[model samples]
Target: MSGPSPAPAASDGITPLQQMVASCSGAILTSLFVTPLDVVKIRLQAQENPFPKGKSFVYCNGLMDHICVCENGNTKAWYKAPSHFNGTMDAFVKIVRHEGIKALWSGLPPTLVMAVPATVIYFTCYDQLCAVLRVRMGDWAQEAPLLAGAIARVGSSTMISPLELIRTKLQSQKQSYRELTDCIRAAVQSEGWLSLWRGLGPTLLRDVPFSAMYWYNYEKSKSWLCERYNTKEPTLAVAFISGAVSGSIASTVTLPFDVVKTRRQLELGELQAKNLSYQVSSSTFSVMSRIVAQGGFGGLFAGFLPRLIRVVPACAVMISTYEFGKAFFRKHNQERLRGPLQTRNT
Candidate 1:
């Protein structure tokens, strides 16, 4: 009766290499899709000084060399009447009309470079850690996803923190650095090597908790949906819905930390651009307190709308594509293994 439960039928989960491949594909696609949203989000969050209506100001939120004008109640870029952005749509239109469509992808190069390795490490580590923790925890395995996700994020974020700093700086000012190496060299020369890791504290504060919540909720939601739908495995739709729900919840809760991180990064970029030696505050709490003091509690939540919009679909598309790729590899591996067995039997 039980010949050992038929030896559990050999699991067909994809290998780590497959996972990395899937994750890389997902990261590239997600970056291309969401860069516009990211650009707009950064612009909104980095704006500290308000450009009053009908006033021209040198607006630099990663894309320098633009005179922001408020004309007809709309913020226009580059030598138009000066005004504040009405909202996200206004910003989008102005950026396109004045800066060109490519402006929306201002940080694409660094983003793509960061995304590939970051996502590969992140997803692969999460998957591996989850498997290990599940087995180790035994009966409490249900909590593995949260822990694994948090740990994975910590590792990946730390590894890619420097790239993230560069990406943020590049996004905040246009053509500030002649090249990537020039940016790194300037920061190192001005602030020492540690400067490259600036804003990492706020980054971890935002990312680790978000990762924990996102994976926990995603797993729970996917499980519930699967049960309701009577499916043994998650479909693309299930993954997408789960990702959107989890991402939105996580992004909202972590929005404050994100705002702080953006501010810190932008300040650093400005300092480096000016070649100024004045160091900005590096403490996460200090930054948060300053934001609160300057703009009330609501200030901590700048760019919430664009962030949510970006994260929801970014999570949805990225996770679904990643899961689909994993599934495809799993099936392929199973067939490949089975072919030899069937041939031997025959």
Candidate 2:
């Protein structure tokens, strides 16, 4: 029998630009698959006390009573219904049944706009920062991925938050600004341009630690998998499993912050606009307190299952594609450069 195939070189000749391109492509493709879950997660997170209601029809106007869980057409209190998704699969079915298949992709525009560039910047910085630290710290470079991921995520968040704010609002049932410009204009007119950064604080809280944990776990898991499986280059299955495990762990640890972030981004200003009562505070601490008071500790994990499911697969796809893309590009680019030299030698 032929000898086992040689292990592929790890990140050999993988330039920062190539890393970025690979990451961006992976993230965009992932977003397409997972945006529906994102929509459901946002809706679940945006649920608040005394939910909104309006617009009712008798013969199932694309919405079922159970699907819109909170608001019942027969309630005689409001025109619209509250969302009542059972879980991830239920959310998918309900959204498609009631709102049509297209509804699953709500806010996709802002998602892509934010995610593609954010991913590019994050991966590029991660690679460069790891390189610098690896040279300086030797073994300590193992921790570099964690710090680099966190720092890169925070840096990208400044730009990504505004788009996220818009997307959250668009995805939320509380308001429907059909156009991206409409959302921006409305926020500017109502809350000033600064409003676009509404949840930056909580976003940072969720993202920084999340990024650190995710990258750290991902790196460690990758190393462990390779060693356990007796492979140098991780197969796609190995990469996907490692990423899924890492993402699930990180997501679970950081879920409470995500709930707070979504609420702060989507509900705070809307409540203010409608003159509704909310024990509002600028601090995430106080917001967390309010959520706890409202729904007990369990409320902190409003969309935990869906978020976990979405993140696991999304992370798997993104990480695997990123690794594969880097490998492909690196090999192709080296071969291209070598061709000219080989011809000269011949």
Candidate 3:
């Protein structure tokens, strides 16, 4: 009998190009789905003053121009819209009714622009770094995901931080800038170039730890689920569940830093909007202390509910979509290789 045909060469799992494509797709979908939640969350977290009910005020969040009635004392939005949101559900209803549905997607343009590249860099780097570190660490490979996730987050967050600053400004503003460039020009002229990177320090503090925890938990959860299900690779369900659990835990733990980051960025945006020369403090701890003094310890956890709600689904959708996309490309590549090999055998 003829010797068994040589085993087919193992296909490289997924190329960086494939990873980028997958990550881009996931980012766009996640932004579209979660932006409304984000808008409400920011509005809640950034509101320092209360609006009395039935007060009509001019609302200009992103491109929206409307007169909104504040139904609750707690309602606020980008540009001090009079429609006061009492909570997450209230914010959703008021924003939709007063500003129209499109207002829910305020800041979507900047978010998409920022998210696509950021997610691509973040996810692809994490995957590549994990692979490299796992091999290099040998017996210590189990810790690779934690280090790789943190490193990837630091790199990606630093690169896209300017965009993040812009996005937050767009989302939180109550006034209409003629265009995005107008906002950028105003900020640069007033605050100088370094203004673009405002809040980056708090961003890194929040994100690096969140990334490390998220990836560590996600890997462990995915592995356990896969083993339980007798699957060699993670399924969409596995990815979704793992991501949701990991994201919820990380988001909760890192929320206080998120609150600080929002306050810092919003202070800058407000200063730029009003053409004020006053300097805002950049100390994260200072902000935290002020928050505690103002709202008590509860202040540090502002918007916790909406944030948790947003993060759970956002993580599930983004990660599952990314994994599915990567799996698709991997299968396509393997099939392409198989076709040539089979033809050669014949």
Candidate 4:
């Protein structure tokens, strides 16, 4: 049999509600810090090279064309580069200079709405599932963090995918959305409630593998680091570094899925507007094929650099805050309940 099932952290008496709340709290705080990078990533992903004679979004065509037409840059295929954003710092500079600081937070509302609940569901389910898997698998269960993470993501993603779709729609828009509610209302009114889940297939494809790789890498890294340092608990530095490394690995592996998901969702919106059937771009394979046909392999990795930059810190903050939040809240809750109970007894 296995050595023993992993025990829940109960420094202050763990509860399901408390677990969910702590996860949500951590995600919300991280979201605020990461929202700007998120916007740049989304904008970069949504943009298409207009110079390429195809169905691309052609966002920077005018500017690029103006440059080429006027100054005549050496490389005619300079626009063939994967995405408009050169790097993280360049993305920030270009977005702020061109679109204004406010644009960097364009989809914050919908993202916040989704992220809290998504994190809550994901973390709670991950812990619960891990416990169950450990009981069944014994010693081998600890080696299966990827399985636990994938299972947990399924539950969380199914619940929150609609919100993810909405957030993507809002964020990837070339035009501004007044608010989250406006975007939701438009989706509902135009394409019925089903529109909210238009790209769930691709979301699952992206997220399931991403979560599996991320959680597995993180757990492995954390375990190694803790053992190397001979610590019972991971230090903040350890957690941050582990989380960042894991996030980067997972993100790079699953970036193509992310690109396909965004394209499918963006196309879904257009199809809905035109009242066309799903055949325009129905399947993930079809979308992938089209992307390859148009832009070659580079299309699959659009916005990778900015995504990497955003995800590393975002993942580090998320996991670190989650661990800290759980500890802090548990202690706080214990003291809060003790105070009330002690007064009543006195």
Give each model a TM-score. Answer: 0.76, 0.72, 0.76, 0.70
- What TM-score would candidate 2 get against the native? 0.72
Top candidate, metric lDDT: 3
Model 3 off-target regions past 4 Å?
Answer: 1-12, 38-106, 165-196, 278-280
Please list all clashing residue pairs in model 4, or write none if there are none.
2-138, 2-139
RMSD of each: 6.8, 7.6, 7.4, 8.3
Candidate 4 worst ten-residue window by lDDT: 61-70
Overall local distance difference test of candidate 3:
0.72
Task: Please report, in order, the local distance difference test score of every candidate based on alpha carbons.
Answer: 0.71, 0.66, 0.72, 0.66
Candidate 1: C-alpha lDDT: 0.71
Extract clashing residue pairs from model 3: 75-84, 75-85, 79-173, 79-174
Pitting candidate 2 against candidate 4, the one with the higher TM-score is: 2
Candidate 3 residue lDDT tens string, 258-327: 7887676555545545456546566999999999999999999997986677778888889899888987
Residue-wise C-alpha lDDT for candidate 1, range 1-346, written one tens digit per residue: 0010101111345788888999988887787777676566546643645344433322222111122223322344322222356777887888788778888776466446666788899999998888777767877777888898999999998888777666555543455556767868876999899988765677789889999999888888888887788776679998999999999999999999878766765555555555466465668888888998999999999878867776789889898888788878878998998999999999
Name the lDDT value of residue 110 in candidate 2: 46
TM-score of 3: 0.76
